[model samples]
Target: MTRSARRTRRTTRSLQVAGVSAAALLALSACSSSDDASSDSSSTPKSSSSPKLTGTVTVFAAASLKESFTSLGKEFEQAHPGTKVTFNFGGSDTLAASITGGAPADVFAAASPKTMAIVTDKKDAATTPATFVRNQLEIATLPGNPDKVSSLKDLTTSDLKVVLCDKTVPCGAAAQKALDASHLKLTPVSYEQDVKSALTKVELNEADAAVVYKTDVKAAGDKVEGVEFPESADAINDYPIALLKDAPNAEAATAFIALVQSPEGQKVLTAAGFLKPTA
Candidate 1:
């Protein structure tokens, strides 16, 4: 072979070898880059984004839950930027009736299971009701207990002019249970439809005292004095909460219920003179 041809052949072989080496290097670099990307992806945590909550969440709650639930509602609104929490605070039975009667409510928080059953029995609750807190009866008297009402029996004094919640109300039912347990009878000046109304009697000086929840007396602050009795232990009412079946905003309603069952929500309730639920 001619020298020029031999040289050309040698040069072509060298270039081919270099081209293969370059292609191999490129493949190795690409593999390394892919491995690094996979390792980085495996080590990194995915960002958790919660669904945005919006619109109004209407809650029908017992009168006794007014203070604490109101606070929770505000916190819920703040945590969920575009959401609003509206409440219907009233007698548990009335609220239950409203729920069963097709009133648009996102949630229900009742003072007693019996009242909650009024809605649950009709399948109006989206979820099984869970007890969130419990409350016991207390004698609410004028500030400083002006009449010296020291015990449940003291409220029985003919001239004391006590007030009581109506028999249908949880507060009234619990008060009756306590009275029955103590084997003492109380003749109230009037029977109010709800606990707040019954407590109002004492705060406004319309009645000397009233049988109500300790939470209510605490909420009244200096307006009324609280008198605890041993019989009240046997008459504690369990407050239960549930998501309504026909809730306008079921997602937000469920979230609110979750918040109420959370530790932060319990702190608010406990501070309002509510007892932790046993079951």
Candidate 2:
């Protein structure tokens, strides 16, 4: 153990310690760099997988669907948050025309297959139309049987003022078909533009009888009485529903469509007096 030898040994040991410390610092720096790189990668924007449907949905439906669609619209809003359902209720033909003409619409429910065909032809429909319900003609009169109009044959009487929808509307077309099948032609005082208007005339006691859907009579409550005629079966109009291609919120539109076809929707529609589709 000479002093120089001891000093050299100590100095060599210190150098080794310094080398080890430098290596440890380098290792820590590498690990820190790796963690930062990993953090950046993880934080990088990725395609979101969460499904969120938020927007406005516009529905164009036949005037006949007013009551049923109003309830369904409220239900849809409750089921989907951040969504507003705006309904445009009018004649099926008119609604189809509006939709096909580039009107913004999320869905459409028509009172007749023919009207639905118009949208399908224009490729405005997102999917195949499905029949949800059917409706038949009924003889609606004042609650007290003022006209005593009991049979289809009785409608031909010259004294009774009858109101009928124009051939353009579904009910009117059906009434025409039924009358043609029955070989009975009754003169109507006025050719109403739509079924509701035809029914409204009866409701207001403006006309003695109007050929309208049974559901319309029911929806009118006690304002009018419904007379079921056997010939009505010959002219049942099928109701159809479809999602529009220009839907603003696709997810919500799909969900709403599913809801309408569901059992709950069926029940709601039935409660509104709509008959289930046979097909």
Candidate 3:
């Protein structure tokens, strides 16, 4: 052959080798970039599922929840350092109205689902309310079982001077249901605005008897006597709780709610004579 032909063949071979090296380098660079991207993605922190709670939480609860919820409130504050809890306890219906009226509260706990419905209907609740406890009606009497009040029908006695919660309140509603279930009608001496008021009438001997919650009677201690009637079973009030839609301290409110449904909270409520929510 010829020397020029040999040289041309050598040059082509060298070009081929250079092209292969360049392709290999490109592939290695791409692989390294992909690895670096994956590593960066893995190193990124993920968002937490639960928000960190701080600050104050205002809770609006039923009148009957005064004793139990107050205890739980203290516990919640202890569990969460740098947190404060304030409460407004009143008739369930009244509290519901206050919340719907734009009361700046973080949480709401009602004695009856019907009352809680008022808040839910107005979209004042942040989430679906949950029943945390059950309450039953009882005849609260001036200490020592005076007037011989035995059953729900006994409240109908004309001479007893009985006081009842207005039908608008949960306690009154439950009491009316129990009386209706027993086929009895009673005309109370007065209709109070809340359970505490009705219970107070009996405590002060202003009325011979009042249809109030068992918890109220228990909390009253020696001041009033409690009588349980079978008809109360037909009118059990399911207590529900929820965080408000425009809660000032949303995270703290949520944590407070969880604490109420926790075992420790159940213990405190049961001790105050509230029934456990049925399965």
The prediction achieving the highest lDDT against the true structure is 1
| Between candidates 1 and 3, the lDDT winner | 1
Runs in model 2 with CA error above 4 Å?
Answer: 1-50
Query: Tens-digit lDDT track for model 1 on 185-261?
Result: 99888999899999888888899999999999999999998998999999999999999999999999999999999
Off by over 4 Å in 1: 1-24, 31-48
Report, for every candidate in turn, its global Cα lDDT versus the true structure.
Answer: 0.94, 0.88, 0.92
- The collision pairs in model 1 are none
List, residue by residue over 1-279, the lDDT tens digit for candidate 3. Answer: 799999999999999999999999999999999999999999999877754567999999999999999899899988888899999999999999999999899999999999999999999999899999998889988888978898888888888899999999999999888888888999999999899999999888899999999999999999989898999999999999999999999988988999999999999999999999989
Model 3 TM: 0.82
**Model 2 clash tally?**
0
lDDT of 1 at 240: 94
Each model's TM-score? Answer: 0.88, 0.80, 0.82
Error of 3 at 228 (Å): 1.1
Q: How accurate is candidate 3 locally (lDDT)?
A: 0.92
